[model samples]
Target: MKQVFKRPESLIDVPAHFCPGCHHGIIHRLVAEQIDQFGLRDKTIGVASVGCSVFMYDYFDVDVLESPHGRAAAVATGVKRSRPDNFVFTYQGDGDLAAIGTAEIIHCANRGENVTVIFVNNTVFGMTGGQMAPTTMPGQVTTTTPFGREVATAGYPIKMTEILVHPTIS
Candidate 1:
């Protein structure tokens, strides 16, 4: 029998826990596919952040570490520094990365850490009752912002990649 579909070796066989309409599973598959393509399954170490994808350790076949809420970048930094030969990455959502772990992520990028960050910007805090996250678009509504987000008061959504690449950061 010819198998047309097979799960990436870097991903586990267990069912995912991500909710419907959520992109966590798709993002996870992409990450796993990259790891498989690079033949990094054995040498890759993943840092699982808080929020919806906290159970990432159960999905990825590689070694996975759990970081404190919003501390995945810091934890991945230490892991990469301790074992420079390994490929380290962090799986973080908008709520965890853009809101709680902003400082940690900025510092990690500024220092040019040898790590990859798989940031999933779903706009809302999916794990925490769909609250308004830092990545929530302007005029978008969430549980916390019942009347839609007010940029005058809430400020614009943060563009993390731009902040990371800003010249002022270096």
Candidate 2:
């Protein structure tokens, strides 16, 4: 018999610290699978920003950088610019990428940075309790908005990809 469910070599052989029912571990597995499939284990550098996945450095075997809150894009940009030969990627949450680091990601995309970004949008801020995030869906309830989100007063949940792909004129 052959083993078909071996863990990816790019990922550490340890249990993840993510909360139960959370998709962070799933996302990590996907990233590790890609790294292993592309034989980039030796060339990949991951940037971990503040949020639920901040302990990613302990999960991946490759070099990992811990960026300030919502600054993963900027840190990854520097890493990629300095080492253009390496494959740099950033793992960030909706709160980090869409709310706090909005400008960083937009500018990085605009400048065509040679880096990959894995943005996880869970709607609420996972690390800091279940608070409303920039990607929260319409009428979604959170710690910050116990009565469900009020679009009239709170404005709309931002669609980051839309803004990145096509910026609207103010």
Candidate 3:
């Protein structure tokens, strides 16, 4: 038996820009592993928006495109359509996906866009001073919700996957 450790070929061999204990590093490795496994590194495009995930361009060895806040999915849609041969994916945080990018993601999924959306739901806007995001659970406290999120006013956390899975909105 032989044991070996190596970096994914699609991943850049460099220190991650994420904060200590951040899962972004692990997730990035997984994305890179998939890219390498599928031999899609040369034909892959990662879309990142205004959030911690925007640094994906620094970690992944493939081509990356930066988008405005909450527009990763929309940008990825265009990329996948324009370059049908390329594999397109978006890396977005809770605030970027579940909040401002909600409509874009929903529409993209509903349209059956051939793209992967890596939505990171951390509850807080980690890149923006720990603010409450749409994915923040009820009763969660943050800089914007020091007294906890009030369901009566804030409603419930948006379950994006579930919303995207339903065939019809009721």
- Quote each prediction's TM-score: 0.96, 0.95, 0.93
Candidate 3: segments with Cα more than 4 A from true spot = 1-3, 167-170
Q: What TM-score does model 3 achieve against the real structure?
A: 0.93
lDDT of 1 by residue, 1-170 (tens): 99998899999999877777778788888999999999999999999998887878888999999995799999999999999999999999889998999999999988888999988898999888999998899999899999999999999999988898862632
- Per-candidate Cα lDDT values, in order, are 0.90, 0.89, 0.89
Best by lDDT: 1
lDDT of 1: 0.90
Global CA lDDT computed for model 3: 0.89
- Backbone clashes in model 2, listed as residue pairs: none
Q: Where does the lowest 10-residue lDDT sum fall in candidate 3?
A: 161-170
Q: Write model 3 residue lDDT over 1-170, tens digit each, in one string.
A: 67598899998889776788898999988888889999999999999887887888899999999996888888998999999999999999988988888889888988889999988778989888899998888999999999999999999988888988873665
Error of 1 at 16 (Å): 2.0
Residue-level lDDT for 81 in candidate 1? 96
RMSD of each: 1.2, 1.7, 1.7
